[model samples]
Target: PQVVSARFECPSCGNIINVSQDDTSFKQPTKCGCGRKGKFRLIEKKLIDAQKLVIEEAHELLEGGAQPKKINVYLHTDLTSPLTEKRTNPGTKVLITGIIKELPIMTRSGSQSVLYDLSIVGNYIEPIEEDFTELSIEPQELKEILDLSKDPKLYEKLQLSIAPSIFGHERVKEALVLQIFGGVRKKRDDGVITRGDIHILLIGDPGSGKSQLIKRMSVVAPKARFVSGKGVTGAGITATVVRDEFTQGWALEAGALVLANRGYCMIDELDKMNKEDRDAMHEGLEQQSISISKANIQATLRCETTVLSAANPKFGRFDPYMPISDQIDLPVSLINRFDLIFAIKDLPDKERDKVMSRFILKLHQNVDSSKEVPIETGLIRKYVAYAKQKCFPVLTDEAISEIQNYYVKMRSTGVEEESKSVPISARQLEGILRLAEASARIRLAKTVTVEDARKAIDLMQYWLSELAMDKETGKIDIDKIASGITTSERQKIVGVREIIIELENKLGKVIPTDDIIKEAETRGISATKVEDSIEKLKRSGDIFEPKPGFISRL
Candidate 1:
């Protein structure tokens, strides 16, 4: 502690004595040259405010899979004020302007040891606005990034650069590139906030390179934390409330998601997670926040993180007609939180197989050939950081019109109440707008263009065609993917419930299952539909079987 000023009044002779309290121990006026010593009153004392911060090195600065190192920085006076403390939160990147200092370590007897610890006494503190600006870019690198952005084939080059060793996933790669350069976070005048981070899920066959892609992304993205779903508990994914021994109260310990705020968290084998663990992530992915209310502590933590997860379909194979929640062990509620879902199948194609085979063989023959990405890992990270910091794109009138037309067209497909096959929802519209904003950011554009809108629309359409197609009606049914039951199946279930109600009104509490089936069949509903609907009703707790063939409303 550095003392600014101190004053003392002597009781022996009523003389006011002043002394500079610069030492850590309380300094006093030892003598006034009048044979006086000790017992000086500390009437006034002032100390300089100070705070210490631990700063971690950026991931891009490490090479050969090394761990990042951390250093302690000491802030003084105005730097330790409450308003300036926001820039020093757990995951925020900050630049320190200061001088290095060393403190000698004390031994057991309170004697100074030979060893010393280093620290920085900061004169200024500045927070970096971008997500991963800890990887500071040089002037030459900025020039190269600007030139690359101007290239006509920049989009193609960027797509090819993501996971290049994996053959032929141009669409997934393109989406991944946009995910790196995410949309700008916005808050409306009404205090409603919209998240900018993108979350993507990959569901496919076991050997379809899902884990490989996740690992590659983890390597490419700066400050990315990788975790296996089966290995993490619910508290490890979100946060935990535990007793704080020092404070004698409760404290929220942030887990992987909260710790990776404004960064990336790549989860692998998501199907292996427990239901409770998946439930904990739902709020964080959608709302970009995690709330904790336990053990007398209540607070919300910001987790503006982008997530890329990969999971294998159940039974180790991809089935196009099945619902996503049915194919994977994840719940539909959890699956819907992902902005984009891609079902990658491993069907055999002669030419594509031959090329992939050649590519793998050549990689083994010459390891150097595996380095085929257009941009190096460090430069790619810097480029993304630069674009995110400098670019903030707003939707143009033309782009807004394009998005409006697409949303209206998709909404019209599910207009009829009888079908109720909703092709899209408001979530998808918001996702498309975010993707368009990301597309503009990648090119450092100030406004989202019509072409950007079309790119986003095309990607959404691709996802619809792949994962949301209903085999029965041959139309894009979002419910088929969002829920296990299609609209037609739901309608049949409703019809069966109505017939059961009519039978109960006339035939007393116990109605035979066969009588209900016969009534459903008379109304053009199939016997199979009736059976499925009865089982669904029983499972949903609407009706129950009292005996072998008799059903009753609960």
Candidate 2:
């Protein structure tokens, strides 16, 4: 046998045993010098072509069924593809090698293996000395097509793509587009754009098309990722630590947010996440980075990705009788992190019912019903393809003033002392502008006009009105969840409070539960009303328990 190389490793007794392989089948020493031995297998080294190396070879060769290992692939060509190169590029091109190493292993068969997925591991380009040559080809025309300012057909396509996929909720669709190409921006004390990432929250009913809108966004955007809240964990959505092979140490692995940097991440079922996990996301949403210190890995990973999330109310639908603060399962802090929050309520009306029925029937029957909607899916793709490559348009001062006036009046009603001081944040300025730009893009226009801003602001106003209201009172009843039903309850709570105060003052001591109920009835309050007030006061900790029957002020 042609002996190649000898290496020693002891499975037991931790001693080295020499092992070698040749052209023929070989056997290992029966025992180790440490008094334990068996046949040891020899490690082999081989070079394979880049394209020929599949995911199976990576798992079998590198991981060896223990853990996945990272291997380098020496690509013969750069992935930049000269056809897609831009003129005003800032030398930000990353050289990516064509390799399929870190893919998910689905199943394996003899001489065949299946991989779930693959990703591009990109970094600053480094020039290799030997066997490396720059290949030149015609610059790609993709950029020219994406420049909507110069391309009319591209804009036409984008309008059609979103026009059909999103039915009846044109307002939500407009907001989504602004989030995409418009890109959110924040100014620091120094007047620099500090927070440039955009985050949108959709709080709506179960069938308000929030899910459908997000699904459509995943397809239209060039670099977009969609994930469900129930499907992701803190470590999975953000980042985690894994074993490192080169230094024989643990390395931090990038999560979905980090991997989707400079892109869009659509998260569904936002309310189902754990409180701790949701809290962990606050920093990423605002600062666009995840700072985690665990297992000696103290690093801040980049998460400058736009987030589009959807959630249902705590009790399945919006309750107009309750505050927006009390209706959602998520915390106010997390909700405030979103630049814009749209409420989608399912209202039953004749026109809506007829349209919904016709739409569903046509969809299930696989028939083309909206032939004259002026836009097609292919056109939408072309429109987005073009819009991404163009410079963003500016919203004129007239548009800004219009939006400011609308925002100021909606929030200045002073419904409650605990309400938000500013109905709309400065961040919304950017949101509105972007939304207008997208609306213009849908029309395949060169500039965002005042009419576009008006439409966007109208939608924003509707959402703001729904979110900021005293459902118990008669102020801003947009969704009709507030009617004569809540006023009676409010009156009862007030009467119950009065009865408790009167009973306590007269008795000059703790009030017995039965006596308190009787006193409340004398004051024209029902037994049920008195009981509810007791429960509410107990919950609020205004009243405490001496026993189950006796109540005293805390």
Global lDDT of each candidate? 0.85, 0.61
lDDT of 2 by residue, 278-337 (tens): 787888887788898888899998777789999999999988666764677777678767
Clash pairs detected, candidate 2: 83-140, 146-386, 154-383, 157-379, 157-380, 158-379, 158-380
Q: Which stretches of candidate 2 lie over 4 Å from their true place?
A: 1-160, 163-166, 184-198, 204-208, 317-326, 346-351, 367-389, 415-449, 476-537, 540-543
- Runs of candidate 1 with Cα error greater than 4 angstroms are 1-88, 92-130, 133-135, 242-250, 320-325
In model 1, the worst 10-residue window by lDDT is 243-252
- Error (Å) of candidate 1 at residue 439 is 1.6
Model 1 global lDDT (CA atoms, 0 to 1): 0.85
lDDT of 1 by residue, 197-297 (tens): 88999988878888898999987887688899899988999999877532457777888898788889999989889988989999999999999988787
Number of colliding residue pairs in each model: 0, 7
In terms of TM-score, which candidate is strongest?
1
TM-score, each model? 0.81, 0.63
